[model samples]
Target: MTKDWLTTGETAKMLGVSRQHVVDLCTRGELTFSQPGTHRRIRSSEVQRLATSEFTREQEKSLWLHRALLGPLMLDPARVLQIATENIARWKPLQRGDGMATRYLEQWDEVIESGVDAVADVFTSKDERSSELRQNTPFAGVLDDDERRQVLQSFREHRQREHAAV
Candidate 1:
């Protein structure tokens, strides 16, 4: 039997996002929560339904872009990690915690710190936050300008093919 309520962490795992992302959802009024005391308790039904949530067009694009980084990341995890942390450090002091970028970067930083698997999950997961996380990814310089152009062309062609089929 399933319980009616689940903690943010549980919901985050179920949603394949950071626990903080679940908290952020609650904070943004996107997910209602019951705070019995210290932590937020979300409705299991609400979270379950969100699993079927549609990935928007922008989210789809971001997913594909992140996919471009995945191969290099997997081939040389240590170097990619170094690059990501360096990128994060460069962006950190400037954030001042005023915008969504700051918060998402923090989440991505935590994932990067957790090691390759965690970071890989963010890039490859078919979950909602993966797309959102990519928007604020600290994976700059993972690919060079030429690589970026190639990826952009491939993505454009893929989309064009999709549109043609539809």
Candidate 2:
């Protein structure tokens, strides 16, 4: 019966983890599998038994917190902020070592740097005014013919480039 089994991707979806995490579990002897041809196949019964047997306090808490975060609390900005802070705190300790922590630290650093670059982009473009102005603003009626022609020409060129791809 164990000859036909679920693939790593299938098991990962059922277990709510990534394919890499499943691979780690297999390597650590937490999960058992058989390599047939080009794929690793895990027995569903074994996975289910392991899932049911492991009921540690930390695991329970993690599940509950994960569900809560994905539910009604998802719309609450404060809750989102608190959860992000908790994740960063958990990540910091792991970051001190040269293993998974290092990888997480690098990912977090990139995320923060990208955010800074986005903010910088908005400020840099703020001073460069376009020909179009707000209807209620003082510059609404000041647009000249040449400025209007320049805007139309720019738009036409943009459309031409966009349609060329199709």
The numbered model that scores best in lDDT is 1
Candidate 2 residue runs with Cα over 4 Å from true position = 1-4, 55-166
RMSD of 2: 21.5
CA RMSD per model (angstroms): 7.8, 21.5
Give candidate 2's TM-score. Answer: 0.34
Predict model 2's lDDT versus the native: 0.48
lDDT of 2 by residue, 1-166 (tens): 3535888888877776556657766876778988878777899986786566543222332233233323323355344334444555555675446554345444444433455343223222222110011100111112246754654566557557765886
- Residue 18, model 2: Cα distance from true site in angstroms: 0.8
How much is the lDDT of residue 69 in candidate 1?
87
For every model shown, what is its TM-score relative to the native structure? 0.65, 0.34
User: Poorest 10 consecutive residues of model 2 by lDDT?
Assistant: 128-137
Candidate 2 clashes between residue pairs 3 or more apart in a chain or in different chains: none
lDDT of 1 by residue, 145-164 (tens): 99988888888898899878
For residue 36, give model 1's deviation from the true position in Å: 40
lDDT score for candidate 1 against the true structure: 0.80
